[model samples]
Target: MLQESHTAVIARGQHWRGEVATEPYEAAWAKEAIFFLRALKVEGSLQGTRANIQISADGIHWADEGSSLAVPTTAGEVTFCRISHFGGFLRLVVALPEGARIQVVASLNLKA
Candidate 1:
């Protein structure tokens, strides 16, 4: 995790180089929030990968807020920016194929 004043940059989870069904990261923010998503270059065998942004009024129940984004499986990078108008909970959901090694970073800015 990294922080600059009110902004926070974090790795959703450990190096997702193993086989996992779904990796979800959650955080809380003000009513109006800014988010940045970036997928680092992945290594090793690659396959179908997907990611999406989700939000919720409560942490337990979440709803997809943005269109499903395809995650680059090869050695490349992808990024996305979003400004949320509702809900106080935000998360990034990523699906990695078996034998896929990936690293994703997320940054959150909370208005003062």
Candidate 2:
């Protein structure tokens, strides 16, 4: 069978200084997805830079799927997490400590 897949750049070279959520992407057709966050530059504390996976039906409200992505802290490092059984929309809620910041890119890959 021919597989269909797509990738969305949720965040591009963006600087996150505090807790923030990546822009949600609609992927209802996908049977699987992988969320990636790459830290190109880091500042302040190195630990506790993680994200909570969230799903939404209408792309409006969201709830944690009880899964978290352990993001890389050092530059030139990448980390990802796979997810399934999702809703129409998906996003990651990243938590950053006070005075902590990271320049990174986030992407979501979908497969059907």
Candidate 3:
């Protein structure tokens, strides 16, 4: 049988400051998933910045799934993280340096 797959663009040309979480996605059918985060531009240092893949049951609350992406300091760089055994809803949460802003595009890829 062929596997099912899908990609969702959660954040598009959006500017992130301090900390932010991408919109939730429902993918209970998916057995595997990956998140791609692209930094288009940065207003300050990317030091100490991190992005984590979070899972949720009702889409309103979230918990870290231990899957994380190491955010690059350089602009135009892309980072990714893989996750599995996630319950249903998923999202990406990023914590950036204080007073720094990053314009980014976040994509969630899933397969079953």
Residue 67, candidate 3: C-alpha displacement in angstroms: 1.6
Cα lDDT tens digits for candidate 3, 1-112: 8999999999999989977888889999999988988889988888767898889999998888988897767788998888889989999888788888889888889999
Off by over 4 Å in 2: none
Q: Measured by TM-score, how close is model 3 to the native structure?
A: 0.93
| C-alpha lDDT values of all predictions | 0.58, 0.88, 0.88
Best by lDDT: 2
Residue pairs that clash (backbone atoms under 3 angstroms), model 2? none
- Per residue, candidate 2 scores C-alpha lDDT tens digits across 34-90 of 998899898888586678999998889999988888767899889999999996899
Model 2 Cα displacement at 101 (Å)?
0.4
Candidate 3 clash pair list: none
lDDT of 3 at 56: 91
- Model with the higher TM-score, candidate 2 or 3: 2
Worst 10 residues of 2 by lDDT: 42-51
Q: What are the candidates' C-alpha RMSDs?
A: 5.3, 1.1, 1.2
Off by over 4 Å in 3: none
Q: For each candidate, what TM-score against the reference? A: 0.61, 0.95, 0.93
Angstrom error of the Cα, residue 81, model 2: value is 0.4
